[model samples]
Target: MEAFADWLASSELGQYLLCREQAFFDRAVADAFGFRAVQLGLTEYDFLACNRIPWHGYAGPEASADVVCDAAFLPFDSRSLDLLVLPHALDFTSQPHQVLREAERVLMPEGRLVLTGFNPLSLWGSCRLLRGRRDAPWGGNFFAPTRIRDWMTLLQLEPTATAFMAYSPPFSRGDWLSRWQFMDNLGERGWSLLAGVYGIEAVKRQRGMRLIMPAWKPVKAGSGLAVAGGNERHPVKQSVQDEISHG
Candidate 1:
């Protein structure tokens, strides 16, 4: 995982994919308003930079993370965060389904979840097959978009938006990548599923009746209801601090 992080920060191909993913995240997170937002991994880059959420932070098993912890066992309370971003975190982790389960556990009802993953049905997947599982990304598990959506469905996360990007074939050299840049526009129009990466935005849903509370009634803290207003210290933050201190 550390090798993959270094590759994303330094390699030419990594930089290209990062630029494309950044653009997608910038648009995906712009409209997701909330009190607390947490990005699960890729701590080196700020994927939540475009979010309007007042209190946002990173949590992962990295020294640079605001709260160092495993993605599959997040310290946050159930239904605590309003928005969560996972940038290629699932692809790298061995417990991808458990990580998704953890993601569902931490998000509040109606909270938004955004994730990006490499598509196995794309040109990039073909390149990975040719590489014989030799490196950081190629060796990582590549899941199809439909499979990810199916997993999200079982977790009651309704898909709101989905997009495919990085249509160009995987090339190590910058000049080769630039020459194939036109494929991006063409791929979006003709063969979207064959794109290198896919991004998904989903909202958590709750079953049963939702009663409207009277304005005069006192609202309890950590009630698992969405709160909007000035930034305040949330219970999730406290849990994060405790986890860090105890560790």
Candidate 2:
């Protein structure tokens, strides 16, 4: 994680990816309404900066985090958080599935969950395969967006929106990256699923009972009345009938 952070802070390609991801997060989290929000990883960056939640904080293994804890076992109570952001936390975590389950447990029903991850079906994935498992980001697990959606569906986290970014190939040189900028637009317009990174916004859904009103039978006018001396004299029933007539 530290090596990946260092690369993000230093390498041109890493910086480019970071910038694009930040922009994605900014737009994704901006309209999410909530009382409490938390970012699970990438403690160095403020992924929730654009969020209007009353309380937002960072949680990670790093000392700089407001709540230092493992992503797989978050310390928050069940259904406590209104929003959660995972910025490549799943890729680096050893227990990515557990992390996602923990995310589901902590989020309230209808709470928003936003996550960014590397796509394993893209050019970037091909590069990582070529580079082997010794590099910083290449060593991390890259899950496909479809697989992630399937996982989220199992957890009842219905995907609401998604965006793909960083369509350019992973090039360390600034000039090379600039030359490939045209691919970004092309990929967004025609080949979005093959983008290097993907951001997903999902909402927690829980089964709820639909309210059903009890059926009431209407009283007939002469049913509960007694014919006493040719006069139907039931004061209470008469009052009820009067009320119903008026109504």
User: Which candidate number maximizes TM-score?
Assistant: 2
Span of 10 residues, lowest total lDDT, candidate 2: 227-236
| Candidate 2 segments exceeding 4 Å error | 212-247
lDDT per residue for candidate 1 within 1-247, as digits (tens), equals 6677888888888899999999999999999987999998889899999999999989998889999999889999999999999998789889999999999999999999999999989999999988877787887789998899999999999898899999998998999999999999898897896799999999999876889977897657773332235245444455565666699
lDDT for every model? 0.89, 0.91
**TM-scores, in order shown?**
0.83, 0.86
Error of 2 at 182 (Å): 0.8
Q: Under the 3 Å rule for N, CA and C atoms, how many clashes does model 1 have?
A: 0
- Candidate 2 per-residue C-alpha lDDT over 1-247 given as tens digits, one digit per residue, 9 for 90 to 100: 6678788998999999999999999999999997999998889989999999999889998778999999999999999999999988889989989999999999999999999999989999999999997988898899998899999999999999989999999988999999999999899898986699999999999979999998989957655555455555553466665776699
lDDT of 1: 0.89
Q: For residue 206, what is the lDDT in candidate 2? A: 93
